[model samples]
Target chain A: MTIIANAPYDFTSNDRQEDFRGAMLVYVGWARHMMFASPYCWPLPPDMPFGALVEGPMAQAFAQHPDWEQADWSTATWTRNGEPFTPDLSKSLADNGLSHKDSLMFTTPGLDGIGGMGF
Target chain B: MDIAVTKKKLGLKERYALMTRGLGWEPTYQSVDDVFPMDSFEGIKIHDWDAWEDPFRLTMDAYWKYQAEKERKLYAILDAFAQGNGHLTLSDARYINTVKLFINGLAPLEYMSHRGFAHIGRQFRGVGPRVACMMQSLDEMRHAQTQVHAISNYNRYYDGMANFRHHHTYLPYLQVPRSFFEDAASGGPFEFITAIGFAFEYVLTNLVFVPFISGAAYNGDMGAMTFGFSAQSDEARHMTLGLEVIKFMLEQDPDNLPIVQKWLNKWTWRGVRVLTLVAMMQDYMLPKRVMSWAEAWEIYFEENCGALFRDLARYGIVMPPCVEQVRKERDHLSHMAWCQFYQARGTNNFHVWLPSKEDMDWLSAKYPETFDQYYRPRFEYWAKMEEEGTPFEAATPPQQCQVCQIPTIFPVAGDPLTRAEHSCTHDGERFHFCSQWCQEIFEDEPEKYVQAKLGAHELYKGNLFGDADPTAEDFDPMAAAMAFLKLTPEDSGLHSDSRDAANFDLWRGLAKANEA
Candidate 1:
């Protein structure tokens, strides 16, 4: 499936982790929350605690959703890059095995979005 | 005494052969491989350049006469539309946003097509295709110009219409189409023809053009409708060239079938991703809808392309595997794409708004199986939020697919609620895709896609804001990004709140008073 080229095609990926200047790109999706359109991508320090992300950026990202107020993060189920996982609140993103460009989807079992229609 | 001699005129076939095939000569001064080095590199084998059947018998002299005539008629209409204050005659200011999308997103691709054709026209060893590509190159250039001339009248009275050329380069959402053309233009000659010619022009052009043109007609836009009419003949030639190039490649050698098939798969998925914008426009942007995106897909893609693939089947080319996924998505593509645009409206050059009750009813009727059940509820919730003065806006940019450059807004096939997410790590770096099709395209050409300048990635990295320091403590990144994209505050936000809407009301009121 290699590209047919006259010469060898080689280059560095444009968005490699080092290009972020000390921040790692992480994507967060609130599962069943179609209201948000798609997963939000942000650049954050890998050493930042997972709880801080949920409290700071992730909370702000989903604050407009009506179900955000009713959702309990502690009881939420999580998947990292489509695999099930549990995050220790105190653990840094790096400690929780979250790498650059890795996507995390969280679902609050009780909060199924507005009108329970998965919005 | 003489000889009075009258020379007989050349017949159509003779003139075509003399004008096309007669133009080529054996390269004795330079080796043929040295002159046409690009043709062989893509692994397509052409045993005889002479075997290429000229699709159109158009000569340069006749081409100039025909195109000049089209331009003359088109410009006359454009001038009349302007003098007649045609911008005031549009059904609504919301319809202008669709034109904005066209000028910003699609017109620039026409220019890119011009460049691609011009490049490949010289690269092909066959004189017949060379002549065909050269004509198509001129046609594309003319299309780009006429479109700009047509929409330039709207630019005077609209906010988003201004800065289209700039937006095509830097606008985040526009990168979907920008990158699609760039991907095609950067490929080899065969891949370029197959990607833009066979896949985009032949298979998908109707979906893109029919909606915009018919929407223009339905929405009372004479300028855009006239431009559409002007371009229709050129599009027919381009489609014929598309089919001709594909058949020529396949018929030339058996080895080309698999290569062409691979490209068909890749470009079909790629073209579909780019058309998500057009789908959204058909469904949401047009005030007086011509047809629903689902209906357009059923007609343009499902029916027309279905027949085309069947025709191609005898040449051992089956439908692209991605067609199944596209069928699953046909019902929901526009809804999802419009939702994405609506949520991220602040960042886009064009304005977005919640569909009216009537519009929602139209959507319900159009998309019986999914619209009311899946999309209407979401729109209703957003409308409620807008009523409460807390309209939902995405706080951060969505992750973009590396291949398509579209925000990963597509839902999983047959599953309307969940977003489709696929990613793969190459050389210890992760690249995300909207679906398995995009992932496969990337897997095939990791070398090419890995170098993608993803818009969101660039936004975060501070590369998008030209000469501005994003790291400054007081600097606002979003504002700076907007400045870089040349989008004024008037250019974006809710359609109801936009300056275009305000001006439209004022002018129409004035015109009515004058009539009285």
Candidate 2:
């Protein structure tokens, strides 16, 4: 299944960690919130706290959703790169074991998008 | 003494042979393998170049004459349409967004196709297939030219059409088509023909061209309809060449089957993913919809491509495995694509809007199983938000598939509510895909796909902004990115709020009135 090239075909991934300067690319998706269409990718420092993400960018990203106001993060379930995990609110993303391009998905069990159909 | 000399005119078949395969010669100074270096890299076995048949014996002279005649007739109509202020004659101004999508997203691919064909034509050692490729290369170039000419008329009357060439390179949605063509063109000769000629031209051209052209006719766009007509004959030739090339390779050697099958699997998935834009246009953008995207898929992919695969089965080429996933997706592709476009409208060069109630009803009727239950409520909520002066616009870049390079917006199969997310770590770097098929394609060619210039990644990396410092305290990233994409405030937004809509109302009103 290798590429049948005349010569060696090798190259660095264009979006390698170093390409983002000092930031790591983290993708966040709200489970069942189809209104946003897809997960949003943001460049944030690895040292930034997980609570800062939930309060600042993630909150802003999902603010327009009807269920956002009623969303209770303390009761919400979370996954880091599709695996179940609990984040410490005060801990940095790196402390939560997140790396570059890793996806974080959150589901507010009670707040299932607008009209309970995942928008 | 009077001497009379008689010369016999060569018959069509003899003339064709003389003008085509007869033109090739054995190289004296260089080896044949050295000259056609790209021929063998893909591991396709070719025993005899002479066995390659020319599906259509269109020599350079005949090709020029026929195309020139077509050009003459096409231009005359285009000229008449232009002089008559034909832009105002059609359906609603929103119809022009479909044309904008075509010009910006699809037209540039025609140019890419030309380059692909031209490159492969020079690489193939077989005289017959080489000539066929050469003629197709010319046809592709002509198609690019005629498409630009036909659609450019709308530029004078539309906001989005003015910067299409620029948008084709920079727009995130446009990168889907741009990257698709670049992938095909960058592959070896065999892979290129199979990807573009067979998988695209033969299997999927109907889905792409039929909807756009028929949609044009339905919407009173005589100019685009005529362009479709002009290109129809060339497309027929291309399709025949597609079939001929595949059959030729299969008949030449048994070893070629598996390689071709793998490519067929890969390209079929790739082609369908790229056509998400067209699906959105057919379902949402067209004011006078010809058919729903689901209906088009049933006819084009299921019915037509079904027969094509059955025909190809004798050569041991089964229907691509991706079709099962595609069947699951047909009902929802357009909805997902349109929703993505609507939220990210500000970043695009074309306008997007919520489908009218009638449009939704049509969608409900067409997609009986899913539309009303899943999509309608979402659109209704967005409309309500718009009415309340709080419109939804996504400021952040969406996650894009590493292989296809489209935003990973597709919902999980059988579960329409959840977004499908497939990712794998390769060489310690993470790659994401919208579907398993795309991930498999990446897994098969990790080296090739890892080098992909993903648009969203590039945007986040601050590669899009030219001289502006993204780090400057006052600089806005989204605004700077939009500026980089050459999208003006008037160029993109809700269709109702667009300059195109405003101008259409003003101009059409004056055209009907007794005085200005």
Candidate 3:
């Protein structure tokens, strides 16, 4: 499958329509379960974490973390229709469009876009 | 419904672009703080208006136009259904007993929701959110009137539909919600929002709408569904408003966090207590089964809310403080509350029979957290014993909860007869409650939420109202209305001397209409 990486916040060269595709990642205040898809992609499973785990034990001892593998690393994929998808259905990054876009925020976490910053 | 008339087919475009933000002129005279007083409590600092986002971009005229069209369709359904022999589809005239409980307990609360939301609509400085609230307020009122009107047709057939206005004064079943909103509306605007908006919408709205409305849909109750789904489409907007309002408050002030959390706890318990009547309705009321409270809670709360809370945790909002305890009690609610109704029905008074075992079993399985484990045995035992004809007598209600107005379902982890536990002293009166959660709420701001509650306080003193209106005395409200309508024995079907079918046709002109 074509993994769409950090789909909600990232951008493309083509400034196409709004990306509600991964907007489920941005909840108002409560955790809500969402099953959604990119405009042309199938819904990605919830396990695939896009951000770094800043705190907790995993941050220190990356080993003893028995059987811990990224969700996308173990998947097999194929296509029946025109689309490609992972068997496990985890995180994905769709094809980059042509030169039409606004500034992307997922990459530049330090810059809040208005200039202040999120990270 | 006359399919052409419903606004759903017309698909009103959300017009907020024009009526809300579109109509909002820049407030040159007043600063943002002057216009919207509630902002600035959340620690998160934002200097730009663009940071505020409205997910449902609704406009005012779109709301009114669609809502108006929805009402017209509902009224037409009531008219056409009544004009036909729609009453025959009912399982029995006795079934209206459930509808009577509905009119008395739920109908008026809709109006209160409307009034409360109107206040919110005007208060929020943000045009997008305010307009959403305005639309919700309008829908709430429509829901109230439509419910009363839609059920009024059954008045001619059922013994109980006419008595809602009177029975509510003494009926424990009806008093549950009445006592609740009376307290909610009487309190401060914030308290009302916490009570009705956040508590009712965020927590309890699904319990009523999903089970109750779905039952109406499954039971061939067309007018009811048109009314419910039409109102519910707007209800999601209210839910959005609730989530937005709470988040907006928390985002504006960090100190508001602790305060809002307390309310989340208080209102959740209060609202759950008030919904006991709905629980009874689910487990025992409908002739055709719908989802049980446990199942509804599983899907709406465990799944939907579980996800919602986890997302909120990232932003620092916690679930209602005592949610785990609430989670544990879902199974107990349906059986116990329905027992209350069955008890009320025993005296040849008001109540509905339980749905078929199939519905009960479905509920048990779907709500594994509640039914399949803890509550299922009780259902199975009751079913088996009931088949052998054991007397199921009405148990006297425990002393009314001082705040929420239902019997304390709060179980003692150890003792049973204590009727739950409480030791909160408010103004020298050591208040008793059904659970630790409720007691904490009473203690937190006794003056605000608890002091004004009229629990079992005034009932023994002989001051229940509604008998004063001559209109309130009949056993069937629609029949009473027909008496006022002077439609003769034929139209007032409850008259002992019901006219023969042929004569009735002549009098009401049913034959001529058929020919036309």
By lDDT, who's the top model here?
1
Put down candidate 2 lDDT per residue, A1-119, tens digits, no spaces.
Answer: 66768888878889899999889999999998889888999999999999999889988898988788888878999887678889898999999888899988899987877777777
Which interface RMSD values do the candidates have, in the order shown?
1.0, 1.1, 29.4
Q: After superposition, how far is residue A40 of candidate 1 from its true place, in Å?
A: 0.2
Report the lDDT tens digits of candidate 1 across residue range B1-516: 889989899888888888888888989999999999898988898998888887678887788999999989999989999999998888988888988998998899889999999999999989989999999998989989999988888888888878888889888888889888888988899999889876678666777777668888889999998888788678888888888888889899999999999998898899898888888888888999878888788887888878878989998999999999899888888898889889888878889999999999999999899999999998888898899898888868888888998888887899888878798889898889999999999999899998988877898788877878866898987778778878888888899998889999999889778753
lDDT of each: 0.87, 0.87, 0.52
Tell me the spans in candidate 2 whose CA falls farther than 4 Å from its real position: B1-11, B471-473
Rank by TM-score, descending? 1, 2, 3
TM-score of each: 0.98, 0.97, 0.63
Tens digit of lDDT per residue, candidate 3, span B1-516?
A: 556754544233334455556666667988877776543332223344334556676655556687778778878887887887665555433345556667767777898788977886775566666666677787888888888788887666544455555545444545667766766665544455656766677667776776787887676677666777777777777777677766765676566676567666677777878766777676666766676667677887778778767866755778786777766666666665654444334222344444456766776665665555444444454455456765233222234444565554445433211224344444333344557776666565455444333322332222222233433544553244334322233322211122332333353465346663
Name model 3 segments beyond 4 Å from true. Answer: A1-119, B1-18, B25-51, B92-95, B163-172, B186-191, B344-349, B352-397, B413-419, B453-455, B465-516
Off by over 4 Å in 1: B1-4, B471-473
B401-437: candidate 2 lDDT, tens digit per residue: 9988888888788888887878999889888898999
